[model samples]
Target chain A: MDFFSQWVAFQTIVTKEIRRFTRIWVQTLLPPAITIALYFVIFGNLIGSRIGTMNGFDYIDYIVPGLIMMSVITNSYSNVVSSFFSTKFQRSVEELMVSPVPNYVIIGGFVTGGVCRGLAVGGIVTILALGFADLKLTNIFVTLSVVLLTAAMFSLAGFINAVYAKSFDDISIVPTFVLTPLTYLGGVFYSISLLPDFWYNVSLINPIVYMVNGFRYGILGVSDVSLWVTYGMLTLFIVSLYTWAWYLLSRGIGLRQ
Target chain B: MSSALKISGLKKTYGNTFEALKGIDFGVQPGDFMALLGPNGAGKSTTIGIISSLVNKSGGKVEVFGKDMDTQPYECKLDIGIVPQEFNFNQFEKVGNILKTQAGYFGIKPGLAEERAEKYLKLLGLWEKRDEMSRMLSGGMKRRLMIARALVHEPRLLILDEPTAGVDIELRRSMWDFLREINEQGTTIILTTHYLEEAEQLCRTIAIIDQGEIIENTDMKSLLKQLDKETFVLDVQGDLEKVKSIQGYRINLVDEHCIEVEVSKGQTLNQLFSDLSELNIEIISLRNKANRLEELFVSLVENKGAA
Candidate 1:
């Protein structure tokens, strides 16, 4: 198909996906806002009052960026995994496979959908955080780029997960076991500087740490890691994950017989 | 004129042991209404699956309107539409959205997609239910929705796998009319159906597959002619107390008011009517005891099994 045609196909998929999530707002959009609001109240207001400050910023302000990034990460990952796997379960994915739409367009469309949901939930969380803490952005470029890139990278990760998923249970295993642990230990609630040198080095290996700190630096101009290293790691993960996801889709793993 | 679809050496093997299709070959000419008939597990679905790109082929070549599937899949896909045996659409979507969404997947513009969706939904008698969720549609309506969705892109070739599997007789006949209309308008149609009567009434050509092989591929009339004998049932107005021994014909008293007569090739039905009249049996109605193609299909498959 030509460029115009491919674009139309891509737009169709994205629109369908968006409609799917939005149509079920109680399930997809509402929970994140309510959950993040509780986090702001309990962690930001209650626990934060007891803990004075971390990394030279108020405890609530220090955790705001991390909290927003965490929402972005989980929301983005779950959206694609659930939507794509549901498409497979319903056998609706064959609609695209049998059509003339190219493989990259399929992957690109779903990833864009994932990114949309991720940023949407992230935006909601950011607005909720404002009610509890005085949030300010030190760099709009860094803040927006980090959030966008992180959502995209995790969306690709979720796409790969959906491609190999045989059942609904398989889609959630990674996020619950691997993703939850990584986000918690990724210095979301505290800085790695608070850890001992050995554990601090170990924390560097978790990819979510760079994303959290990158956003933290963007919001408060304070980062435990260098911006250069954070940007480099995010770029590497995005490119690698995207290429691998594209390969899996082209191979038709867990899709075609 | 170019063929609408051509398959050569097509093969499919499931896992390591089951061979669904064993290097079969067939061609569907433009404007030809053909039936690909087979019993259960005879590779009819496998062939349809491979052509629609739902199943990966183990070996062979498939070309749609002279475009090779391997190299020009997009071009080929653009020319063919498939209505699978089962419902594979999103039940949550509105009836109209399903067709429009399907057209969009083929890269059709929203305006044209809407137009095509409207045209087909109306043609399929689904215009009033356009905004209703697909899950609410009845069985026959759902089947019609699938047909409308397949035609939204206006493909050159339309393939339907048992499109009327469970439809009522009246709806099935209407669907047959719609299919014939499309074929008349230059769309090549390939249908797979378990109903031999449906095939006999609609398809001009027929292909029968059995045990992963094409046992018969010929015109419908030629295949029907292969049946050496045809049994027909006659309902009589009065009760017959005993069987009549007709010297030249084989006849059986099915009941008091019905009789079955076996007619051999080259036998004249007028002769049997004359013989029955002489026997004082008044015929109320006459009909084939079984579909002609059905007899041929069963015998062909049985012979292939014996071989």
Candidate 2:
């Protein structure tokens, strides 16, 4: 099939995946929103009252984008991992295997599903953040671009995880050991400028730093790294991951018999 | 007829030193019903897996309808449908949706998918089960559902792997009729089974695999004819022990007053009868006991490695 037709097929799989999540709104869509709200109550209200603003915004405003981005990363990653793994477990992946659909369509269909869940949770978290902080968007394009890049990156990561995973335990290991640490140190609640120089330098290594700052630059017009560098790094990360993902898919890495 | 599939030196070896397929070659022609017969772990599933693109091959090549799989898989795959031995449909989805989604994988539109799904489900006696989750279906129904899902796109080559292994005899016959109807309609079918009778009744050509090698591949009748040995059951007037001295024959005592002897073709039964008569064993009845198809199937896989 041509690119246009393949994309239409990808769209169908994506819609089915999205409907699966939306149908279970209580389990998938609602939990993260509520969790972020709880974070706002304890971390922003109770905790921020003692320490004044570090980035010249209220503690609630400072943490909003980071929390939302974190939710997006986890949701997008989890959605693909769980969904793809379930297909593998149930042997339903053979449906695509037996068809003439190219490997790229399978990857595109699955990654888009992850992106939808990520964006859905991110969007819901944004609404929750709205009630807590008076946030503004100085650059709409940068804000949307950074959010989308983050989604694409994590969704691709999730796709890779699902491909290599043999069992349910294999999917959970990265989230617990790798992803949680990266998100915690990504400068979510605090600016790197407030940290010691060594720690601040180390923070630059986290890919999430560029994304959080990129979105922060879009909304608050204040950022630690130059917006270009953040945008450049995020773009590079997305391309490199996408290329690797496509290569793995084309070779039928863990999907083939 | 031109070959529908041609395989040459196909091999698959995993990273863990497990060799699943060891350079096997076979072919099937258009509208021919071919059966791959083997014991479990005889590489039947692995062979089907590689053909359907589910398994990665380590070496060699496969061509479908004259197109090399590695060069233009889409051109080859467009006409092929694989009904895997295992149930591979989504248990969470309704049967109708499962079949429709499979059609969509081939870029077929929803309307076309629906029409095709209805046609297959109804034909398979599963139209009412359309709304039920696939996991809820019985084992036989689920197997039929796999066939329906495979043919939703009207593929020209249908590969059925053990389609009716565990089903009842009646259902097995019904499935054979159904498959034969499709085959008559110009769908070349490649079936793999441990059930030799299924092959005897359905396939025109048969290949027997044992210990990762194609031991035999020929017309079904030819393979059966190779066993030109005849076996007969004799109902003797006297005790069975009296017939033990038949010259140039192996005697098997079925029960008292009856003895079964195996003789090479054209080696006269009259010779054995007279030899027994010299031993004072008079027979009341004589019956042929050789099932040639079974004999061929057994002798091929009888721990003798390759034929």
lDDT of 2 by residue, B122-169 (tens): 999899999998999999999999999989988888999999968888
Model 1 earns a TM-score of 0.98
Query: Each prediction's Cα lDDT score?
Result: 0.92, 0.85
Per-model TM-score, in order, reads 0.98, 0.91
Model 2 RMSD vs true structure = 3.3
DockQ score of each predicted structure, in the order shown: 0.84, 0.59
Q: Give me the candidate number with maximum lDDT.
A: 1
Candidate 1 whole-model C-alpha lDDT, 0 to 1: 0.92
Model 2 misplaced stretches (Cα beyond 4 Å): B15-20, B230-251, B257-291
Candidate 1 off by > 4 Å: B237-244
TM-score of chain B of each: 0.97, 0.87
